[model samples]
Target: MIEMSWPQVSARRLERAGLGAGRPATGTGLATVEGPAEGPVEGPVEGPVEDIVAAMCGAHAQVMSAAEASIGLRADGVTRAHVRAALWGEGRSLVKTHGPRGTVHLLPARDLPMWVSAMSSLPGAHTAAPKSIRMTAEQTDQVVAAIREVLAPAAMTIDELSEAVIAATGPWAGDLVMPAFQGWWPRWRMVMHVAAHRGAFVFGPVRGRKVTYTAAPELAPVTDGLGALVRRYLAAYGPATPDQFAQWAGGPVKWAAQAFSAEELEEVVFEGKRAWVLAGDTEVPADPPRGVRLLPYFDAYVVAGRPRELLYPGAAAARALNGGQAGNFPVLLVDGVVGGVWHQRRSGSKIDITVEPLGDLTAAQLRELDEQVDRVGEVMEGRPRLTIGPVTVGGHA
Candidate 1:
């Protein structure tokens, strides 16, 4: 097994994530933001937003606003508008869809078919409902078919789709079974992500305040299967264990282990345990990632990197993480490890950013943190007011 230091692992992760020094600019055919923030600072840009999203596997979009900051701040000169355009533009090179953990994410549209195929075949990840309210296999199949047929002609709002689905699949499919925001959700609604993963439908543009679903393009054959998906995960966030992979994907550990066994991987030892990276992806930096980074809630880097203890050492383990969850709060990265948590509230043209560091930062680190603040403000489209004291906010604020 190859021996690797923890810092070396973090450095390689930073390099893959395009946060390391002298990162390359790889975003082609991407539009720049319209205007700079009031007090923008020039910084290094890695690439366009789409390419950045692709490299990071996908940007978590559970909080869409946070996702904009997560993707935009990765590159210099990128703004919130650029990320939104990539997602909603004519090219639609980037897409909003269900990804790992069945959560909303901004995935590269070009890669969506592969993701869909792989996720559709994943061992677990299906419509989750109580046994009393669960649909049988035949019922589930009927609901999926109804959704595909109903949305074939054009996009449909949730209400429209719901009515059409019940008409086609029978009223049993519409029985209110799951508790939602204000009322109960229909049984067919439980299979929404399942239908999405199976390529039956993809998220369409929002109409006014309602979300729409459209028929997905015909899917190509599943030539690569789960192996290809695993490789992509390894490339973006590898040198990891099957347990970590399962945790990230919200799949079973046994299934992840079997998948790893099928791949040709190289074992590496870090902190006295074994982990794996792709066969040839063993290079590590002589030094770990330097400089400060303020990652938004559910940032890909914060969620995917493993050895949680190392990434969230000391006070960060408590403050940045909520009950062992990695992405409950926006994290402050000091050389690729969690150092603090931050929160921002937009007030018209200006954004009030409060950073709560778990430890004292050097003057140089503090200055770097300021530059990070400026970059964040640009993507969020507001002038930043940095306060290096306590954030005093709740989880995901």
Candidate 2:
């Protein structure tokens, strides 16, 4: 086990490590995440691009909604539009649901069924309340039946579903499904439950209009296919422990452990930590491009698992990653390690980037920052106009 300093790593290093000119790198291997810049974004011959694209599509299979796909990709440096382009080649619907931990997340098309099953296992809170507010078993059954009926045919908007629940349970709507949390209505909790049980799939939630929903199919049958999906995740963002897998998969620790029990995975030491790596992943790029990238909130690099301390350090990781809220910050990646913070805004064709370095960087660091910013502009279809903040040159503001 060899320990490497976190300060020496940056996002660009991670991106270019062990990547090849062709797509075979992604086929069931430990391939680093890459975002091609200077070179034309083209794959090798013999249907490399299409095959990899198809594989990518397969990895996210069963995902009908775009909103869900967008968020997942956005976590990984791709934008909502990028996901749409990959899926429909034209804009279309995606799925979103109130996931575990009382938050909504974009479900990956391929992993939706497994995710649904894992989420369903979490015991609902509606049954444990006091007699004055507790939902009896019979009442719970009635609500479940009603929800099944309403969702059997097709999905419904939140408003429509709420109305249907209200209609089915009659006056009990205000008390039964919408229980009083110790006497006060827990609307958010109710919404999460309703969304979960219906097996409802979400499409693009048009800006201000109602979000469209549709009946989700029996995702259980297809869930067996997730073996490859899990492999892909581990390969793409790996060197992770089982506990990390459990957290990322939204499943129990036992299940997370089992997901990787299949052949093709090997535990390896990354920076001295016992981390799993895909057997197929071979190349670990040395002397990767040093660049600074301004990542969006909730970027995949930050949200992959619970190891901010591994990614950052003691006090800094604690403050920046508060219960996974690190996604909210505009992260600065210099040399693959999170170096500082950056703010970005677009004004017409010009994208303004303001970088605040946590410490003094070498000349090589500035060059790396330029490379990343250029990529961001290309992805966003804008011109790069960087404004280096004085914070990096001086002390913290």
Candidate 3:
């Protein structure tokens, strides 16, 4: 019955999010049992792309590895198999769904048919471009067709894909090509995929390996059925306003609201503002472990929201949410908040992680950091080394 400020509400509201806890062990059943209100899971788990995206609504898959993204999502009940099934279900091709500032994302393997149906009805694709390039709908459609033909059989790098499209579409194609098409063509050559039912495209390799993209046949006919999943996104990340949904959705707010508002959602006031949550999502245990997590810059977990205040300090939040505006740097999490930053440089089988704690680390905390570095080493092919560096809280260098 009392009014609360955003900070106070944010602090209390996010306190229950359970984001900073490191990866939970398998069989822990953290998510299946009572854990956090955000869903279930103590730490993160590795899973396929689509499953993870389905559970989380939005995923940072474009930038992070399947393993890396899974590690983060395990903390919230999403798994690799789930992600995989979403992308390549039933051995059929999936469609790419583009929204939220025009970047294309992967949709569930089983959900493409309906997604494409709904999206095709919408007009005007948001072409993420610099001030110079302008393209008409007729031109855009032609390019899309040209690119599709080039990418239909096999995956090609962005350059290869672009060359093929240009050869067919003519020189003017380069001037009129939108950034999404430019970004997507290469991925299409690599392997076709769908982003939440919008369109079909491909993804390139990550960490020196070509990332696999696949489509699902079952999802092709259920355009109207995806309303359930849209509502799911709102509940898990909501209590947020519709405007926030639009931004996070990477699509028009009008469409996102229409998708989400079509269902039954529970409303709650979190951090002093109105919010909507899924009717059945349970709360996690209040007693969270004093855990630490290392998150990459532009990682989806933190970027899913419009503002970073829910999970980061004011200054740090601004940099993280720049929306591809700045370079991504790895971050250190002490408990659930960003307490410092870290960087690594590899030389001769050694990956040196230069740790810059916001404050001095306790001996125990230091040891924990060391263990985490070991995991990073595994990720970087078994060369684990550590370094101590001096840095301000928000400073990257």
Q: Each candidate: what lDDT?
A: 0.79, 0.48, 0.48
Q: Among these predicted structures, which one has the highest TM-score?
A: 1
Kindly list the per-residue Cα lDDT of model 3 for residues 294-368, writing each as its tens digit.
Answer: 655444445454345645565555544344332255667665556666766668778767877776778888887
> Deviation in angstroms for 124 in model 1?
4.1
**Higher-TM-score candidate of 1 and 2:** 1
Residue 111 of candidate 1: its Cα lDDT?
A: 65
* TM-score for each model: 0.91, 0.64, 0.67
Q: Is candidate 1 or candidate 2 better by lDDT?
A: 1
Worst 10 residues of 3 by lDDT: 29-38
What's the lDDT of the predicted structure labeled candidate 1? 0.79
Best to worst by TM-score, what's the order? Answer: 1, 3, 2
Please give, for residues 307-331, the per-residue lDDT of candidate 1 as tens digits: 8999999888878888899898998
For residue 327, model 3's alpha carbon misses the true position, in angstroms, by: 8.4
lDDT of 2 by residue, 1-397 (tens): 3332333232222442222222123222213322111211223212222223222322222222322221332222444355455333432223345444434554433345554544554444433545565555566666656666777776577667667766887666555434444555522234445455335543434335666555554444333334544554565566667677666645566666776786367766665667776664543445543445555555545556335765555544643454545554556655455667666666888877777777777887777678667756655657877777632322111
